[model samples]
Target: MSVEVVIPNATPGTGEGPHWDDSTRSLVFVDITQKNVFRWDSVTGSLQKVHLEDEVGCVVPCKKGGFLVAVGRTIFHLEWSSQKLTKLHEIPLKGVGNRFNDGKCDPAGRFWIGTMGKVLSFEPLTFDMEKGELYCLDVDGSFHKRLDKMTICNGLAWSSDHKTMYFIESIPGQIMAFDYDVTSGNICNRRTVVNFGEFDPTDPENLGIPDGMTIDTNDNIWVAFYGTGQVICFNPQTGKMLRKIEIPCKRTTSCCFGGENLDELYVTTAQAGSTEEEREAFPASGSVFRVTGLGVKGHPANVFNGNF
Candidate 1:
């Protein structure tokens, strides 16, 4: 396998979500703190970006048209061509400082998104804990709360069979599995599939916090470790590490499979809150990378089927 920089210094802040747009044959991602949405076309080798008014957690293509985006506490429909945004739904977080974080669409076309306590600061990083919740926005413009009391809700993915849903909660450093009903968009039977707490904290390899994730065709969970500079593949059934791909930067935020065959792994990193020593160690900290020859393909990204 080979790894190379695709977009060097993509963002100064955190580059969180990475989604492959099959229709456009491009990769779509977001820079949370920067409030920017970006699209990089594979065919033309061109990049497009749009700055939003609020922090953007994730962006997914809509089945009908345009794109579905999670911005701050609200969901918006973005017309990329004209840069028009229409507010869809907003979570009612009265006095709580919570905003949407990482999210994606399930196979059945429901937009599943989660929120985290508002980021107080990046440098010397600080945020409230256990103030997040997960919700599913159905096709008919209905919303359902799936889970709550989450701290830093991050990566989300579904099993190939669509019976299991996987999620990541960064603070506890655990990957959770849920029994999923694709027909009803319900998730239950929550259990831990992988726990970083089981590893020795003193070990350098174990220092990374679990962050964004994706799954291969075989249903193996590939998770990006925030501080470890590695993306590790784990067998969900056995909860065992299968392989580890090292990144050039420490704050490896998220990854997704792109390319025409979905064989290339596109990774996103962050340079926000980096110290001088770390900046020198990883000069390309905020770049997006593409890994080829992994010998595994991913399922095409699911688009939101919502009418709005």
Candidate 2:
């Protein structure tokens, strides 16, 4: 596999939640701390950025038109061409400290998103644990609470058959699997698919916490490790590591499959709380990266079926 820096220093803060828009042939992602949503056109090699008033967590295309965006604790419908944002629904949190994080649309077109506790500090990497929750937004604009008491909820993906859902809880360093009902958009039978145990976010020698993830046509899970400069592939069924791709930046936040044939992997990194030494060591810290020649393809991202 070959890794290339597509956009050098794409964001000044954390870059998370990447989705490939097959209809537009572009890569959509968000810079959380910077409160910016970006779209990079693959064919034209041009970038379009939309700055929002709140911290943007994720962005997904809509089947009917426009786009669905998670900003702060609310979901909004964004008319990209006009740069208009209309609020859809806001999730009620126990405290104001919680906010939306990584999210994506399921095969059935329901938005699955999770929240994280108050960020205490980035330099020392501290946060309030077990204060977050996961919610599912349906096509009818109704919200359903899935799980609660989560710590640093992040990456989410479903199996090729849409029967198994994979979720990442970063602080506990676990990849959870749940039996899913595609039609009803319900998930149950929760179990641990991959457990890295609890990790210390402050320790540079740690194995790294799982952040954002995506699955390939063969059902292999590609997970981006936060503290480690690596994106590891795993066989979810066997819970075994298959391959590993080294990234230039240590704080690799998220990744997705893009390209015309969906054979390329796009990764996003962060430079928000990096020290001077780290910035010098990894010059492409906040850049967007593209990995090609992996010999595997992924399914096109699902768009929200709701007609706002």
Q: RMSD in angstroms, all models?
A: 1.7, 1.3
The count of backbone overlaps in candidate 1 is 0
**Inter-residue clash pairs, candidate 1:** none
TM-score top scorer: 2
Candidate 1 structure quality by residue, lDDT tens digits, 1-308 = 99999999988888989999988899999999899999999898898999999989999999999999999999999999999999988987733588999999999999999999976765545578788999999989898888888878899999999999999998778999999999999888999988886334358658488889999999998999987789999999999999999999989999999898999999999988788899899999999999999999999999999788
Candidate 1, TM-score vs. the true structure? Answer: 0.96
The per-residue C-alpha lDDT of model 1 at residue 264 equals 94
Worst 10 residues of 2 by lDDT: 198-207
lDDT against true structure, model 1 = 0.90
lDDT at 119 for candidate 1? 66
Distance from true location, Cα of 39 in model 1, Å: 0.6
